[model samples]
Target: MKNRVDFIDWLKAVGMFLIVLGHYFGEPFDQFTQPIYPKQLGVAFFVFVMGWGLASETRPQWQVVYNRLFPMYFWGVVIAIFISLIFMLTKGHPAITNYLPFIGGINVLGNFFPSNPTTWYIGTYLHIILLWALVMRKVNVTLPLILLVLFCEIAIRSIFIEFERLFTGYMLVSNWITVFMLGMYMHQQKDNHNNLKALLIMVLWALLLFTWASLLNPLNITQTFPFRLPVEHSTLISSLVVSVAISTVYLSNTLLAVKFFSGIPANPVVRFFSRNTIFIFIGHMPLYDVAEPIALIFVESGWGKRAIIVFIMYVGLAVVSELLHKAVNIDKLKKHLWLRLN
Candidate 1:
């Protein structure tokens, strides 16, 4: 279990890095790594890791929710206010909406708060965590349940499209619950020597994803072929199939990663990123949004500019996150809060 925890930390480090890189470089990075969606894979790693960790949790459900969410809520409001203040000083008009609790304090309801767009994950995560705690965690992990969840996800997405409502970030619980459940199922499995089977499954999913990508964009003219999957082919079935395929491939690869790194110790840098992923995830985008214009002025080439921006955003966030962690001592805070509540 100790080694496995280390392995998951490494996985998170890699996932967080990919997400940060993808956000900074966007389609260009996606084009560079064709056939594999790095950002989506990163998200898959996170969702799977969450499910994996939750499988063995012995804490009360409310405790789990509080532990996972309180820090996010605290930091979200702080960042939102900070960004709003920056906007006020720079643009001469305060983003008054960001001062509100749900709109900016939590910053999780879709794109309602522009201060930090990446936090839609928080809302979706809240929904899925609640669902897991209230319902899914108690039920047996079975084929029928998985299929039902997948079908529900597809139906939900289709209904959203039909109603002309943008699904955005907040309402993605249905989209991601299947992957999360799969992670939990994998954690429940006792077999430790399933590397060959895992590899085979990964290959099959990769093939399916490749075939789907080829079919969707035969000419391969679009740079975001596999990663973005052209807007025209956004059918409900296609979207769900592609999403599941990508997630399966990543999940399978995660098993392979665990097998490969069985006895190895986690790298310090990787461990740092893994431990502070929430800070990096929440902090980097806003940092990038503020710093890019200032940093890009010194660079002429496209790749050079992106590299500079990512370097600054990542390193700067790491420093600030470390300082904040030291000052706030979130673990101690959570324990204190829990004691008071109890």
Candidate 2:
């Protein structure tokens, strides 16, 4: 179990890195440039990891909600304010409108959106955690219930155009429950399945995704959302690929942990990646958003210059995020604040 958990950490490390790449490159696999992994799938994988963590911890609902919600609110608001201020300082203007989403202060109804593009996930995550908390307390969390919730979310979006615009037109918390539930289900059923079976399932999902990708309008889902599908993919396809790939890793890790593939020691690299994923995911975007204009001037059609800039931005933000993560320690601060407020 321990080694299996380690494997999941490794998977998350890889997934998080892919997320950074996906956002930085912007539709990395969309063009026929190369046969690359779907970069946008990274966020979906993160949510999968979230579901797994929820299953593994099995803490009280309030505790789970508190732990997840506060960091998002705290850091999300901070990052929004900070970025808005940077824009204001650099461009010489008031940035209140840019920062409004951070504090739930949108002008129009159904427009309570995050100003930072990446913070949308945090908002979606907040919704998912709250919904899961409420549902877990009310009834047994069956597969049917999971499907029902997903269906309801889709139905609500279909019925209300305004809400869809507010919470990203395509990939809302509602649309994502399926993948999140898949993660929870994977964790709950980990012991019952075998690696070979999981691999087979992954292959089947891949084939299905490929077929669907050929038939669907890929951008239909992401047009108004945080991320659009690469030119020829759909949400269903991406979700299936993300869920199956993560599940495959879980099964493979479990197998390897039991000496299926021996002689691997502690993976410090993977540990670093997992440990700093949150920071990497949150920090990379703003760094790139700021550096992109500069990169364009120095980056002619050459891969070397562009690649170098990417590496520098990623590493620089990672170091800063690590320092901030340690220095701020939001969990402890939240506890302190809660104690005083009560």
Worst 10 residues of 1 by lDDT: 161-170
lDDT per residue as tens, model 1, 1-342: 333456577668877887888876776444323334556667777887788778777788889878887887778768777887888888887665444444423433333534465666666667767777898777777768877876676566555443334334224565567768777876753324445665766566566546654654453434442234434545766555545444455555555554543334577787777777887887788677666786768886587788888877666687778889999888898899889999
| C-alpha lDDT (0 to 100) for residue 243 of candidate 1 | 51
Superposition-based RMSD of candidate 1 using all C-alpha atoms, in angstroms:
4.6
Model 2 C-alpha lDDT per residue in residues 271-336, reported as the tens digit of each score: 766776666666566666566666667775456555655665566666776788888877788888
Q: After superposition, how far is residue 185 of candidate 1 from its true place, in Å?
A: 0.8
Error of 2 at 264 (Å): 10
Off by over 4 Å in 1: 1-4, 29-37, 92-113, 162-164, 188-216, 219-265
Instruction: Point out the worst 10-residue segment of candidate 2 by lDDT.
Output: 257-266
